[model samples]
Target: MSTVSHALTDSATMLRRNLKRMVRYPSMTLQLIGMPIVFLLLFVYVFGGTLGAGLGGVSGGRAEYVNYVTPAIILMTITAAVQGTTISIAMDMTEGIVDRFRTMAIARVSVLTGHVIGSLIQTMLSIAAVIGVALLIGFRPSAGPGDWLALIGVLVMMAFAFIWLSVAFGLASKTVESSSNVGMPLLLLPFLGSGFVPTDSMPTVLRWFAEYQPFTPLIETLRGLLMGTPVGNNAVIAVGWCVVIALGGYLWSKKLFNRESTR
Candidate 1:
């Protein structure tokens, strides 16, 4: 058989195995759907009244703060789903699940691809749910068809980037707990960055971190496409980040996985 055909067969078999596992165990489906929606309701209805006083009256403005929060809320879904995938992958590595897989006849890449694709499927479900709620809250996008296509492209790129980073952590972490622990910095970023509020209101020190962090550019670029705001040329930085993180994380993760497999 040709190498390409063999690779395709391996990937398919791996994907099928993961899909069957997910079918029998539906843990992620609920959490990914529930968590972000909870945040959206909590922040919008509970805390939104408070933010409105200074936010061009989010209560009275033509654009509801829900519109703003919706984007952030969508990100919450991405964070929860991706983090879940990361921790799960890390646990598999630490628990010898990956070792067992490595001993199988499947293509090496298929193992990672299968798990990543499973997580991506879960993310897609979460994305749909979030978008539905956003619509219910009047968070309509004025973007054209092209923007919608571009937005989907951005999301896929974002998903792949996180997948590689998660795989890297899975390979590098020595303990299952540590796999999830080090993500605190990543978790703190969106809140401290422009996701929750305008970075302009933050102190100079905080604003610098908020403005320059990777999430800002990503959030802004996504928000531009979703909200029709002028993200402009600044989006180049965001795209660059996707490429850099995916490439770097993937190389390091593959190396770590190779070393661990031999041990």
Candidate 2:
């Protein structure tokens, strides 16, 4: 086989291996998937009506809150899913499995590639589940087929960016606990942005941060695609942020992986 073919084959094999681990040891994946679902239920059932009353564009009701919060929940799903990638990579590194892979005659990049691909697939599944629950709870969207497709594209881009960033976190951590801790910022970023509440509702300093954060633009873009809200320049900013993060994370992850594998 050619070099590219060899790399593809190796990566596919590693992908399968990681996916099987996800299935066999499902506790971590389940926790990651369940947290967002629980949050969705909690926010919609417990605090939706009160929050929705304060939110613009929607009247006061849990139903309105569901519609408003679904996009944020979907983003939360991505955040949770990428944290799983961090944990998985950290576990493999600390457990000597990565070292074993390094000793084999496989493509050097295959291991990380497999984790990225597998995590992307897992994240999509989690997103679908969250959306399904949202639909059951009266989360109606105004998006057409084209809008849905565009939404999926944006989500995949975001997931790809975060997955690599999480991989870098995994590689930089000396232990699984540290990896999880390192990824906490990612999990919390959605909450800090315009996900659950409007950025304008926040204090001046916080509102400024929320407006300028990367997640805010992505959340705005999602709102536009799903609810037909005005996206304006948020789409461009969201894509730009994804590209920058993906590039930075890829380079950082490659450098970390190479350095660690050599040791």
Candidate 3:
């Protein structure tokens, strides 16, 4: 078989391996999926009314807040799932599986490829579940079919970007605990951005940071796509950010994988 074809086949096999591992250890997957749902429920039920009132004091404040925050929660879902990727990769590295793979004749890229593809599938499923819960809880989006497709596209791109970065983090970390800690800053990005509230509501310096940060454009793009808000150049900016992140992560991951000795 051709080299590229061989890599693809090996990647597929590795993907299956990771998927099986996920099935074997359901707790980690459940925990990753559950956290975002908990956050969604907590924000919508507890703080939604007050938060929504700030957004022009819509009659059903909670309902309005639900729509406003669902996009952010969706981003969180992606972030949460990729955090698992970091832990899973770290475990493989420390547990000696990666060392074994390195000595084998299989395509070298397939190992990381499998983690990226498998985690992406898990992340997308988690995103779908979160969206379902959001809909059930009165989060109404105004997007039509095309808009929904666009939103999904945006999400996939964002998830892909984050997962690659997480893989890099995993490869860099010497322990599972450190891998887990690396993505905590990512979890905070949405909160610091325009995810939970309008950047205008934040202090002057804070608002400036929120406005220019990568997550702000991502959140704004999601809001525009899902809620029919003005998209403007947020889509372009979001895609640019994703590309830069994905490229950086891929390069860093390759460097670490090639140079770092497996624990």
> Each model's TM-score?
0.92, 0.97, 0.97
1 versus 2: better lDDT goes to:
2
Ranked candidates (lDDT, high to low) = 3, 2, 1
RMSD of each: 2.0, 1.1, 1.3
- The CA lDDT of each predicted structure is 0.77, 0.91, 0.92
Which one is best on lDDT?
3
Q: Give the clash count for each candidate.
A: 0, 0, 0
Where does candidate 2 stray beyond 4 Å? Answer: 56-59
Clashing pairs for model 2 are none
lDDT of 1 by residue, 1-263 (tens): 87888778888887787778767777756765887888887777777666644567424432466666676676667767777667777778777777887778767887787778887887877888888987886677778888889988888887778777877876677787887765556556788778878888899999999999888888888888887888886589989989998899789988887787778
Better of 1 and 3 by TM-score: 3
Q: What is the lDDT of candidate 3?
A: 0.92
